[model samples]
Target: MFGRTKEPPAAAQPAEPSAAQPGQGKGRPTPTRAEREAANRRPLVPTDRRAASASSKEALRAERRRVQQGRINGEEKYLALRDRGPVKRFVRDVVDSRRNLGEYFLPFVLVLLLVQLAVSSSGNNVLFLASYALLYVGLIAVVVDSLLLRRKVRRLVAAKFGDEALFRTGVVGYAVMRALQLRRSRIPKPQVTRGQKVA
Candidate 1:
């Protein structure tokens, strides 16, 4: 007891371990604010700008193709605003079920142009007048056909759906546009054959 005085109260307790034991945490000190911010930072520009651009373009092209195919398949979800809804679908069926003079307008005009050119080359005043007369007649016929189509579509839609169906914007124009397009060139391809009755 004299040689080694009684152990002091402070030294009597065992010292606690200062460092973390293995597997006790990340085994590193907590990161400072600057260290965290630097670790999280990203470059403003892509490393491969050309590749990124090409990839984005390819993605957009693929999406367009998907939408186009969906439209051709007559999927309502993929259809454009102008082509959506059962009302529009009924209108498409009505137009597709019959032949419209408007679809022939382009071909008729082409023939008229050829006739006009031939007449001009031959300096035939009678033929020139005839071609002009024919063009006017064709334009009038197309207009008449479009008006009839609008009437028929409105009547059919109102009969099947309701008068309120006529209130939708651009319904007549949509039908007319579809009728004007060549049969083979129509989008959301026609579900019914020509002369097929539309229900």
Candidate 2:
């Protein structure tokens, strides 16, 4: 056994520092800051003026057409927005609402007349006269009101849109408008009454 451990040989010492960093020790050349800046500062020069002009004119025409179409679209949108609520209310009232006299009056009058005729078969008396009067009046009123409503709806549609196609377009516009308005409107949650119990 050796009395003391021998040190490593001096020939096996670490190597000297090179001129470049570790990765650049090979022959690869790195770009200087000036070269990078010069590359960045180069302007994008346009070539082919005829082609550019043609494309540019096409783009300009497209933009102008888009603007014109937008204006036309905006007018319809504005009108639809303005008229939506009133039109909705009107249509709902017309289509869904009951005709108080038309639905009930005619039937009521008929029933009364039948009962009167069955009860008093012998005479043209006061009851008979009154029954006839009520029947005729109710029938007339129902007919008149129905005709009036039909005429009003027709006139309104014709005046507003001029034709069925335009009328349908208007309707679609109104529907879109109403949908937009509804989206914008905030709906409040229903409040429970004091006596009500939750399911």
- Over 1-199, each residue of candidate 2 has an lDDT whose tens digit, in order, gives 5699888777876787766656746576788999889988844655777887899899999987775554433333333343334443343233223232444663576698686877588665788778778778877886676566555555555565455733554543332222222221311111223233322
Q: Looking at candidate 2, what is the lDDT of residue 85?
A: 43
TM-score of each: 0.72, 0.32
Clashes of each: 0, 0
Assess the local accuracy of residue 104 in candidate 2 as a C-alpha lDDT between 0 and 100: 60
* Alpha-carbon shift of residue 166 in model 1 (angstroms): 0.7
Worst 10 residues of 2 by lDDT: 182-191
- Provide C-alpha RMSD values for all models, in order: 6.8, 21.7
Please tell me which predicted candidate would have the highest lDDT against the true structure.
1
Can you write out model 1's per-residue Cα lDDT over 1-199, one digit (the tens) per residue? 5697675566466788798677878858999999999999998898999998999999999999998999998999998888989999999999999999999999999999999999999999999999999999999999999999999998898899888888865678899999999998988999999999998
Q: Give the winner by TM-score.
A: 1
Cα deviation of 61 in candidate 1 (Å)? 1.7
Residue 58 miss distance in model 1 (angstroms): 2.0
